[model samples]
Target chain A: MFFLSPFELKGDIDSVFERDPAARSILEVLLCYPGLHALILHRFAHRLYLARIPLIPRLISHGTRFITGIEIHPGAKIGKKFFIDHGMGSVIGETTEIGDNVTMYQGVTLGGTGKHSGKRHPTLGDNVVVGANATILGPVHIGAGSRIGAGSVVVRDVPHDSTIVGVPGRVVRHKGEKTYDVSLEHGKLFDPIESLNAKLEQKMAHLENRVAELEKEKRRSA
Target chain B: MFFLSPFELKGDIDSVFERDPAARSILEVLLCYPGLHALILHRFAHRLYLARIPLIPRLISHGTRFITGIEIHPGAKIGKKFFIDHGMGSVIGETTEIGDNVTMYQGVTLGGTGKHSGKRHPTLGDNVVVGANATILGPVHIGAGSRIGAGSVVVRDVPHDSTIVGVPGRVVRHKGEKTYDVSLEHGKLFDPIESLNAKLEQKMAHLENRVAELEKEKRRSA
Candidate 1:
């Protein structure tokens, strides 16, 4: 029931190297990386689930959650070359759909908001990057080449090539420029609030000057 | 080596009921609630650590991490009635100090930033509430009754009764009024960004009106 060719296994291993800078060697990755372990077990469990086999798949998924601290429901559909970095406390719901070359960081959740039945979880398009602790809830479609910022809560459909940030996630960028970057560099992410604050500071300075000038003009007129 | 009086055990279990609204029964909490399990194990491990015992304490801590998905270094100091809700992916680093009646949500990290040894992790004062996915790094002090919002990354010392929010956590409210709230209601958290944006919107409107009045006055003067 559980089988993967050497080539396919190597592809999965290589996917880790593309996203994580800390990965040292194959031995270290095999021994230390819980994310890879979770994916491997998830793949096996997913096969069992697809075959309409009961209980064993769920047991395998539960055991995987215990071992890796990453919970992926067996019924979730995932594409090739997907990688989860750190991945502790990350959860993918039963009906969640993930696309190829997606990168998910630690504590991320692709979850359902309510008790609704079919397709309750989110759908991610190819080359989507979900940052640490980001929660994407409900059946939202995150378009290709999109990036969800760390700690953002997304509940809506995002268009292609978009960058989402803030709680109740807002699409801050829709450049349509495809991101080939597998490394979801969180440090460089655009903070909309900080930028807005800076603009406000400038406006305040300008307003102070204008007010002073107005006061002087009024005095001269009197 | 492992013993707790019935009264003490009841007190610990009662702490859960104080924080979590979903906690229906003590039996259910004992059966489930990884947070409580982790704390029980940590208390045992911490005693072993204090007795100048080595290896075994670390081993117990490591095993507890695997079982509960929460890591608490034995060297960390924790006080009474401390409750961790959900607590998956939560980490308490060595030299971390937590005061009485402290509440921590899921994915919270009390961590060190640099390699320097002494008191590397943050200290939480009594009644401090750390929301989900909040990362408090370095040897900072979180004053009593301070609330760190969900997804906040705090690196600095927070004053008593302060409410912190944002990526590089900022003190949004410094009210001296201490919070007795055990439930870290994340939905009600004051978003500094949203407030700033609202203020900006109002300012923009005021500027527009002022500019229009200035233009009219200039036309009348001409």
Candidate 2:
């Protein structure tokens, strides 16, 4: 029930309309807005989690994710200046600690390795940028001022002030990456099945190439 | 968000103190207070969904479920007199059409078979009773006056006035079988791993019996 009345929503809407650069009109947003609903519910549920109520708080968080497709775990500790854009299927795990000035796009999973039981999941240092659907699995640490590229599956710890990209998220840059507040909003909300299909296609292609190479060696041996 | 006003909540608390059964003074329901939150949110979101503002409606529904354990889909057409008990991981598919006087318990999924493209999912007629974790997949029709048992996985069309039970659900009772509307709330939400473990246990027991029979046959032959 985290929805405010039109009277109370007046101030919030006005602020968004006045400050947020992306908005053109309030009517448009009122007419068609999904993010607004998610953001508001998350805020309340997150507050309840902070209050330390058992079962009900967790249930509320669970309910929010199920309806909105934005998965923010009740136990995750997020610091100041955190923003999520088109945040569907973005899973932030329990025992994960997020530092100040961090921005994340859709499908980002700060997950733990499945087998281990207690106090698993990542610890993100200040000013980290996690891109779309990037999976930072295991109890790893991503240091301050690091940029994780889209679709990266990072298993290891990242050093401070580094840029990571591609599958397995290789470091692309290590320039002076300062901690700054930035909001991410764009095409990250679209269908993730496309990216999944692409990964499968690439794997199939690699397997085919290996098969071809093996056939060529057989022919030479013959 | 859709949280109660502090003032209104105070009144509710006062009423509970003054009256024996103010709203929810029952010991069982008081212990499981979160169910009330879930039920209310589902009605609101479902109402919004019926209004045809698709995205926001779904977002609200998701947000509600995220906070609660209940999981009701936005597009699923639920009728009046519909009751949900311990509504956790209860995935009603996009095109599911439920009728009046229908009730379901936790983990019930009116799901689709495969990648359903057109007219996907089942259509449950009026006065139907679906139990816990019962997956009624495909575009099948469960006729009016039917009772689908707990943990049933129905794929085919069910006739009117019948009772179905077990995996690949078979009609265990003929017409005129009494329907039970006794609501039960299990503490645990629908955990897939837990369900898998239960199934595995049953399968293993069956395998052990088969092995024992095989050993006995071999001994007799010798």
Best model number under lDDT: 1
Question: Per-residue lDDT of A31-78 in model 2, one digit per residue for the tens?
Answer: 544344454565566667677655665556556666655566666777
Candidate 1 residue-wise lDDT, B1-222, digit = tens: 555557656777988887654444676677556788888889888888889887998999999988989899988999888888667889999899999889887788999988878879999999888876789999999999888876779999999888887778888877766445423544334566777788877977798579668757855874
State the lDDT at A163 in candidate 1: 87
- DockQ (0 to 1) for model 1: 0.15
Residue A141 lDDT (model 2): 90
A65-115, model 1: which lDDT tens digit per residue?
788888787889998888999898987878899999888988987865433
CA RMSD of each candidate after superposition: 6.2, 15.5
Worst 10 residues of 2 chain A by lDDT: A182-191
| Chain A vs native chain A, TM-score per candidate | 0.86, 0.64
Per-residue lDDT of B148 in model 1:
84
Report the TM-score of candidate 1, chain A only.
0.86
Q: Which pairs clash in model 1?
A: none
Model 2 whole-model lDDT (C-alpha atoms): 0.60
